[model samples]
Target: MIGLIGGMSWESSAEYYRILNQGIRERHGQTASARCLLWSFDFAEIEELQHRGDWVSLEALMIDAARRLEAGGAEVLLICTNTMHKMADAVQSAVGVPLLHIADATAEAVKTANITRVGLLGTAFTMEQDFYKGRLARHHGLDVIIPDAADRSTIHRIIYEELVAGQALPASRDAYRAIIARLVDDGAEAIILGCTEIMLLVRPEDSAVPLFDTTALHANAAISMALAD
Candidate 1:
C-alpha cells in the first residue's frame, strides 16, 4: 500500500489521486485502482504555519501523519507537495515505511533526459531554500536555477492566490511562459515544475525547453513502487 501525505492543497493532491489510480488501471485492468492511503491536511492551517516559519510545528504534524499512515498498513509513503517536503526526512524517520522523495524521483527523470541544468518553479520556500535545491545538487549532481526575484514573487503569488484554489488563469500562464523563456535563455535545458500545482498553470507547450512535471513523475514512481515484486 502507498501512503500519500497530501493536501498541502487538495488541488494538486487531487491530481496525485487521479494519476495513481489511473496508472493502476492502465497497468492492470479497467476496474483496477491503486491500493493507497491518504492523510490530507487542511491547507489553511498548513499554509499558516509555513508562512510563519513554524517548521517545528509543521514537522510534528507531518510526523504524526506519516505514523498514522504507516500504522494503517501503508508499505511505502509519498509526500505529495514539493514545498512540504521540507519535513520529508523527519517524517520518514518517524515511519517504518519508505518515503519516496519527490526530488529524488524528479532528479532521476531530469538525469534520464540527459539534462544537466534545470529551472525550478515552486513556492518561495522551495525555490529559495536549500532543502530541495541542495538535495538536487548534493545528491543528484544537477544544477538547478530559479526565476529572478520579481518573477519568483509572481510565481509564488499565483500558486497561493490562484492555482491552489483551482484557478488556472491565462494571465498566470502567460507570466509562467515568460519566466520559463528567461530560464531557457539562461541555459536551462529543462524546467522542473517543482510545485505540484504548477502543472496546472504551465504545460510543456508553454516552455521552449523540456518541462518535467514532478507531480506526474512522483505519482508514477509511487505506482512502480506499489507494483514492484
Candidate 2:
C-alpha cells in the first residue's frame, strides 16, 4: 500500500490526493483506487520549521510521520510537498519504505523531454534555496534557471499571498507569462512549475515554451511505484 504524508500547507496535499486517487480509478476498473494511508500534519509546525531552516527538527517530524505510516501498513511513502523534500534524505533514512523523491521524478520527466535548459517557477524560498537547485543539478545534469531577483520576489509574493490563499488573478497569470517569455528569450527550452499550485496560475496555452508540472509528474511517478510488483 502507499502512504501519503501530507498537509504541509494542505492545499497542495489536496491536489496530490485527488490526482492520485483519480488517476488510479481512471486506469483500473470501477471502485479501484490506490490502497493508501494518509497522515496530515499541522501547517503551523511545518511552516515554522521551514521558516527557521530547522532541518533537524523537520527530520524528526518526517521520521515520526513515516514510522506511523509504516505501522499503518504502508510499504511506500510520498511526502506530498516539493518544498519539504528538502529533507528527503533524513526522511528516507528514517523510513523502511521507499520515499519517492519528487524532484528526481520530475527531473526524469524533464530529461525525457530533451530540454537542455529548464526554468523553474516556485516559492521564493524554493527557487533561492540551494537544496532544490543542487538536487536538480546533481541528479539530472540539466541546466536549472530561475527568475531574476525582481521577478522572483514578485512570484514569491503571489504564491504566498494569492495561490496559498486560493486566490487566482489575471495579473498573476500575466506576471508568470512575462517570466516565461524572459526564460525562453534567455535560452530556456522548457519551464518547470516547481510548485504544485503554479499549474493553477500558468497553463501551456499561456506559455510559448514547454511547461512541466512537478505535481502531475510526481503523481504519475507515485502511481507507477504503487502499481509495480
Candidate 3:
C-alpha cells in the first residue's frame, strides 16, 4: 500500500490521488485502484508555519503524519508536496515505511530523458534552499538551475497567492513561460516543475524543452512500487 502525506493545499494532493488511481487502473483494469492511505493536513495551518519559518514545529507535524500513515498500513510513503520534502529525513526516520523522496523521483525522470542540465521552478524555499537541489546534485549528479532573484520571487508569490488557492492565472502562465525561456537560453536542457502546484500553471507546450512534472512522476513511481513483486 502507498501512503500519501498530503493536503499541503489539498489542490496538489488531489492530483496525487487522481494520478495514483489512474495509474493503477491503467495497469490493472478499469475496476482497479491504488491501495493507499492519506494523512492530509490543513494547508492554512501549514502555510502559517511555513511562512513563519517554524520548521521545528513543521518537522514535528510531518513526523507525526508519517508515523500515523505507517501505522495505517502504508508500505511506502510519499510526501505529496515538494516543499514539505524539506523534512523528508525526519519523516522517514519517524516511520517504518520507506519515504519516496520527490526530488529523487524527479531526478530519475530527468536522467531517463538523458537531460543533464535542468531548470527548476518551485516555492522560494525549494528553489533557494539546499534540501531539494542538494539531493539532486549529491545523489543523482544532475546540474540543477534556478531562475534569477526577481523571477524567483515572482514564482514564489504566485505559488502562495494563487496556485495554492487553486488559481491558475494567464498572467502567471506568461510569467512562467518567460522565465522558462530564460532558463533554456541559460543552457537548461529540461525543466523540473519542482513544486507540485506548478504543473497547474505550466505545461509542455509552454516550454521549449521537456517539462518534468514531479507530481505525476512521484505518483507513478508509487504505483510501480506498489505493484512490484
Task: Write the residue-wise lDDT of candidate 2 on 1-229 in tens digits.
Answer: 8898988767777888888899899999769887888999987887777778787898888889999999999988988777878788888987788998888988999889887699998887789998887799987898998999999999988877788767889999999899899988988999989887787678899888889998888888989998984
Clashes of each: 0, 0, 0
CA-lDDT, candidates in order: 0.94, 0.86, 0.93
What TM-score do all the candidates reach, one by one? Answer: 0.99, 0.94, 0.99
lDDT accuracy of residue 202 in candidate 3: 94
Off by over 4 Å in 1: none
Q: In model 3, where do residues sit more than 4 Å from their true spots?
A: none
Residue 81 miss distance in model 2 (angstroms): 1.4
**Candidate 2 at residue 33, lDDT?**
82
